[model samples]
Each structure stands twice: as C-alpha cells, then as structure tokens.
Target: MSKADNMLSILWMLRSGKKMTAQQLADELEIHVRTVYRCIDSLCASGVPIIADSGPNGGFQILGTFADSPLMFDAEEQKALVHASVFAQEAGYPHTDALGRAVDKLKRYTNEKQLTQIERHSSGLSVLQPPIDPEQKGRLQCLEEAAGQRQTLRMVYGGSKGDPGTGSVREFDPYSIIHWKGQWYTTGYCHLRKDLRNFRVDRIVSLDVTDRRFERPENFSAKDVLLEQLLPDPAGDPSLVTVRIQAHDHVLNELKQHWLLGHALIERSPGEAVYRLDSTSLHSYVPYFLLPYGKALTIAEPESLVLRMAEVSRGIAEHYGSMLSGLPSE
Candidate 1:
C-alpha cells in the first residue's frame, strides 16, 4: 500500500470506534512499527484529528464528530476521496446512482478555488479502465437487492465443469456483495451445499430474488472469508507449484500492480532480486501472467513451467510460421 492509502486506512480504522495501537496498525498494513508511526505523523500533518492515549489499554483514537459532519477533508484527503469515487463509479458499483450524487455533493462542498484546482488535477486521473461485461451490472443489482432485503436468491449457478448434471439450480441467502481482484462476488449461506459459499457474479447463469428471508450470521466477516479462501498462503501451497522470477524493479513493480500474488517480493539486494509466485491454478495463471513479461523475467523453479514456456514459444513460432507459409511464393 502507498502512504496515502495507509493514512486513509488509519482514519477508517479509527472511524470504526476502535482504538488501534501502532503495532496493530503495523500488523494490519504489513509495515514496520516505525512506518506506522511515520504514517500517523503524516496523517497528523494532513490535519486529521487523531488522538493518542499512552496507557496500557489505550491506543490511537479519532473522535466521532468528524464522521458526523461528513464535510471535513483536507486537500489531499479530498483528492483521494474524489479519485476513489471516480474508480468506484467506473467499476459499476451497485450504488452507482448514489455514488454519482455523492460525488456531485462533494463537488458542491468545494470552494471555487478548490474546485478549479481539483478539476485541473483530476484531468490526469483515471482508474478501473478494464472492460466490464454488460451482464455484470445486472448481477450486481440482483445481489444488492437480495442483500438489502435479507432475502434468499434462487439462481442457476455454474460451478467447475465436471460432467453431466454438474451445475444446478440453487438457493442462497445473500449476505453481501464484494469487489475483489477486479471481480464481484456474493457471499451467502448456500442451501444446496449446506454451508456458506462465495459465488462469482459472472458465473451466476440466472437469478431471482425470493420471498424467503434469512438472518446473516452475527459474526460473519466477508474480509475474513476472503483472506482465508482467496489469498495465497505465505508458506506456499503444497499442491500448487512455486514459480520464482528474477527481474528488474520496473518489471517487478508492474507485476505487483497487476497481480497480487506477484507482490510477494521475496528478496531485493543490489542486483539480486527474486519473487515467489503462488496461485490456485498454476497451469492457467502462470502462462497468462508470464506471457506479457516475455523475455524480461526468468523462471527459476518448477521444470514443468520451463517446458510450458517452451511449448508456448513453439506455438507462437508455429502460428507465425504457418502464416508466412500461407503467403504466395515470391
């Protein structure tokens, strides 16, 4: 995460009415204690009213009045919020109409000079440039409606294709819709599986909001579930193959930005830098991720991957070779 992200995240943490120690902040942000303190200093410098108490039970706190007002933001905070709002809007958030109104209201709150400055700066800002499928909007809307009403959703869900009669109609108590890794998912209690399940919005073949309402688990945490199920394990999975990449900083940064698994950053010392890659599906994920990097990266593990890369190179060469062969003889 960037410094600006850390500052805003700290503010959000305090806003939740929980006092967080610097150590707690460091753990959450995956940064050192000194970096957490530095972020706190940056937040304070930016005019955030963060309060620190120095008792054993005490930690950092922010008064709730700031949230109640809803209009307080320093210049940097305003820019960050505006940028986030733009991203959310572009990403087809379920509450797009409300987000649009909120952005307009925020702009109205800005003074003439601030508005001009924001406009001048925002011209260069853009996010969520990926092409969203048209069907995604409908799926998000259905999930949102079900979650809001505490209603169950009856849908035809397509799971991993195995054989005949694999995918089937199912009912689930929709709890929430979450955006993760550029895809939307709905988590709920699946009646068919007799357990909680996360359904990718795009994989839902069809959906209908049902009259049956179900209570969400009081302790249900979407973030916890996502972390447990989605994020690659630190020790690496025994089943999935490990890929090691040696590359320059620019390529590493690009990989980090584009792929979360690539953000591992195993080692960086002088000219020797290495990144360990772990994903749920190595066959599908590795080739797709490495193709764009081309010759910039070197694969250091999993002999299968080296052979796969060779196969891909051969396929590309064959494709071009055939294309050239098809041309009229000179």
Candidate 2:
C-alpha cells in the first residue's frame, strides 16, 4: 500500500482499541515493523493522540476521544457547514479551492445515513444572490492575504465614478474586507490621499501585494468606516440638515429599506419620516430617488428640496422632449 494508505490503515487499527504493537500492525498490513513505527510517528505528528508504551505488554493505542473525533460533527453540523459554504461561494470567496477541499473532507468522512441527511438538507434550501464578477474573486483573495500580513498593496483603483481602464495608481495598507449591499469593498489607508478610503473590489483593475507593511488603526472596523463614508454620518456634522417627508405606511416601509435612506433616517411615524443628510445627498440623490415614487411621497419640509426636485424633473422632461420636438405628431 502507498504511504498515505498505509498510515490510514494503521490509524484505523489503533482506533479499534486493539492495543497492537509495531510488529503486530506490520504483520497485519504486510509492511515492515520499521514502516509501522514511521506511520505511527507520522500520525502523531499530525496531532493524532497515539500513545506509545515501552513496557513488555504495552502497545500503541489512540486516545478514546481522538479516535472518534469525526462523530463530533453530527449530521446537523455537517449540513450547517455545507450550507454556509453556499453564502461564501455566492460572495466569490477568494480561497474557493481550499474551501472546496475542506468541505469534501467532511463529506468523505460521513457515513451513508449521514450523507443522505446532508443531501436532503442541501437540496431543500437555497439562497439568491447577485452574480459577482469573476475577476473580483482574485482581488478579494489578494487583499485578504495582504491585510492578514500587514502588507501594503499597489493597484490601479477606479475612482467612484471613473472607468477602471483609466484609473490612477495607488498604494494602500489594506485593513479589512467589507461586504455591503451586495458589493465588496476594501477599506484602508490610501497612500495617495493620505486618508482612509474604501475602494470597490470590482473597480480594482490591477493589484499587487508589496513587501511594505503598516499598522492598522486601533479599534477599527472597516464596515463602520465604510457606512459613515457612504451615507448618513455626515448628517450629524454641523453642515448638514434634516429633510422630512410623508408617504403611505407601506411605501415608507419600502423606502426605509434603502441603504442610503435607511441610515439617513432619523425619525418616522405611520405616515411620515425625517432624514438627516448633507446638501449634496439631498439635492443630488433624493430627487432621482423620489422621482420613482411619483406622488406617493411628499416632501413635508425643506421647500428648497421641493423646488430642486421640480428643476430636476423639468430638466429630464426637456432633455427627452427635445428628441420628439421634430417628430411627426402621433
């Protein structure tokens, strides 16, 4: 038998509580006693609790609990582990190959009955996720490796609105991998900007881990920082103000689920809600957001916002209306 196969056979025998010596194991497996000793040593090195004794009657025996460690993961545990992998896979987990091998080992060790239960659980449950770009997976992995080692990364990062092909180069100390609203972002200290920034993983055109290393800020959370950057934290700043709106209860419920509006939201009633936001978000994003709701939502305050929405609607109308100005009446 091959070395691995021979080692596995030795382990199985020891697990049976037979207390067999090296010569006995060697005789049963058709291998030399020295080979049996080597196999036991290999198993011990790999964390198997193989107890060796020197007395005339002593023989190698596996610790009772260690011999049966596979049973610790009951059927439910196995199913849960496998099901959790679905979420990771959907999110384009970077080390998918390693994850797959780990899961395969779980399945390989299961009994027929447990395997049937695992299949039953897996077949009955599923998750819906947006498809991720293939290239983002590699970027996520590289960023993870660099962050784990406190290494800096150099890359061409597309600015929030720039095309990836034309992105400028930057080097940053990666801190964490954050998942928000179906998108992945790497939050870190940007060398070019000399400030903390979040770069969309998909918008990374090229990336390389450098030998350079840096310290992560004390008590930092990438998700918290990303949220503060994306939405409402600016609302609390002295420069921002509150805008209140009223809508049907059902419509308001749907609106509150929005990533931007949800965080900005300050107070709400059955028929009204108030959101705190900077002028930029109010004028730039709210108009388009409310346009989809038609008359379902009313801007109860901030007369400026009402007027701004009107201006936006008018501009859009004229922009599209010009296309039909020369067309024949229909």
Candidate 3:
C-alpha cells in the first residue's frame, strides 16, 4: 500500500479493538521499523493523535481526541454535510436528534458570516416528501435505548394483514430500527415466533421494555441483519411481462434517469421504451407511468394490461365528454 493508504489502514486498525506494534505495522505494510516510525511521525505532524508506548506489552493506540475532534471542511464540504443531514431527517433517521447537536457544534466553530450562509442554504433546501408520522417517537426512543444497552425489548406490534379496527398484536425483541424508502422498520428476534422478524413502526401498537436482557451475538450487527431479512427472496421463479409506452423524450429521459419503473428497460427507440418487468402486478404501475404522458402515450402489453388501460381511458373520455356537453350552448 502507498504511504497514505498505509496510514489510513493503521488508523482504522487502532480505532477498533486491536493493538498494532510497529513490527506488526511494518509486516502489514511491507516496510521497515524505521519507515513505520517515519509514517507515525508524519501522522502526528498532521494532527492525528496517535499515542506510542515504550513497554513490552504497549504498542500504538489512537487517542480519544483523534476520534472526537471536529473535521474541517471547505464550503462545498459544508454544503454536502448539510444536504446529507436534510436527507437523513427526511428519511426518519431517529438519531437526527443527535445530528442537531453536531450541527450546533459546527456552527460554533464557523465564523458568523459562514454560519449565516450555511443556515440560509439549509433553510432553502427542502425534501419532496415530508417525514412520516411522529407517532413512532416513543418506539424510536426505545430502540435507541436497546441499541445502546444491547438489551432486548418486548413490544406489541400490529400486523399489516389485519384491518385498522382489528389489529393483531405480537411481542418482539427489537435489534434495530431501519429507515427504508421513507418508512421506519424494526428488525429483531421475535419472542412469540422464536425467530427473527421485521415490523413497521407505524404498524406497531405499543412498546414495552422488558427486564430480560440477552447477549448480542459476537458477529451480530442490526443493520446487517435487517438488510438480510429485507432483501427479496431470489429463489422464486422469474416471470417476463412486456410493457410498451410511447412517451416523448422528456418522459423517456426521466424514465431512464430516475428509473421510476422498478423493472429493467428491455428495449427503447426514439420516443418509446419496452420494459420487461419481473412482477405480475403490472396494473399497479400502469396508471402512474401513463399519467405523465396524458393522451400521447399508449399501453401495449400483456393483453390484460392493454384492456385495463383502455377501460381507464374510456372512463376518462366519457367523463370529459359529459362535462363538455353539460356546458351551456354558445
């Protein structure tokens, strides 16, 4: 590795629960002890708080200040940080309560004029969708506590399959709360089912902290476990459905760029694209994809989808026709 890369690797190794001797670092980086010492000196000169001990058992360690110090960033860096903060808040990262504190610290370090600019820019930037309901306030608080203490929580969750008036209750041990696609979800070992499960925060009825505490597995990470459970099962058989659209370049560009369609674009032309979607539920997305194009687009798909779109178009046409006929003769 290069000198810079080796220095970063050294920092990462020391930051975690590991101690590295100069000899060890030399071996890892294929360098000599003198070279390692020179790298260490370079790091210390760069304001990286690396502490060295001169005993048989002591090695190199990262100082607490190194981990806790505020980072200096240029104007562009500041804007990027603010943008990420806004995005996190929009996505319901319960820990944003802590981000507010960090932002306050940053403001203190920045000059009055720079701080003013930052505030103005942040205020002007807005997320398209507002945050989800704050009803998960208590749930988020409980999850935070569980994560910090590595404790288990016995909570009552409402099932999604039930009616709003009649929700089924289940007890779960929350390992972590994750925000996916603007929705908050908690994944953990389900006490009632004797296995892992994920529950949406909005669907949870109540939360209860239990006296029972369990040891977190040595290899367990809430984020990793949640992602594993949330991924769609790939073992299912794939189905191919063809969908055709005749949208203008603007719409086609959006479709290519943002890829509003969940499936892959199988084919495209000057003003049209054909998608080979894996889902059988094509009806759900047809209306949305067609709405932007208005009368300029047509759906030529699995005969059923074509019929459904025709039916919707006929309804719209009849409604417009009735409205025009109802207008006073002029």
What is candidate 2's lDDT per residue for 278-303, written digit by digit as tens? 88878998789889897988998799
At residue 61, what lDDT does model 2 achieve? 89
Write candidate 1's Cα lDDT for 183-215 as tens digits.
888888889999888888878777788879998
Better of 1 and 3 by lDDT: 1
| Order by TM-score, highest first | 2, 1, 3
Give the runs in model 2 whose Cα sits over 4 Å from its true position. Answer: 1-70, 159-165, 315-330
- The alpha-carbon deviation from the true structure for residue 128 of candidate 3, after best TM-score superposition, in angstroms, is 3.6
Across residues 1-330, which tens digit of lDDT does each residue of candidate 3 receive? Answer: 688866765665565434679998788767888888888898899988888787888898777655433345666677778878988777776777898877765554454556777888899888876656676766687787886676777665574424443555455666677776667787777877888777878877666677777665567676667655543322242564666777786777777653335335767899888776545446666565666566676665667777767777788889999999999998
User: After superposing candidate 3, which stretches have Cα over 4 Å from the reference?
Assistant: 1-79, 111-117, 120-124, 158-165, 188-198, 212-236, 256-260, 266-270, 278-280, 315-330
Query: Of the pair 1 and 2, which is ahead by lDDT?
Result: 2
Q: Itemize residue pairs with steric clashes in candidate 2.
A: none
Error of 2 at 43 (Å): 7.5
TM-score of each: 0.64, 0.75, 0.58
Prediction 2 TM-score vs. true:
0.75
**Model 1: lDDT to the true structure:** 0.74
> In model 3, how large is the Cα lDDT of residue 269?
91
Better of 2 and 3 by lDDT: 2
RMSD of each: 16.2, 6.7, 13.0
Evaluate candidate 2 by giving its C-alpha RMSD to the native, one decimal: 6.7
Scored by lDDT, the top model is: 2
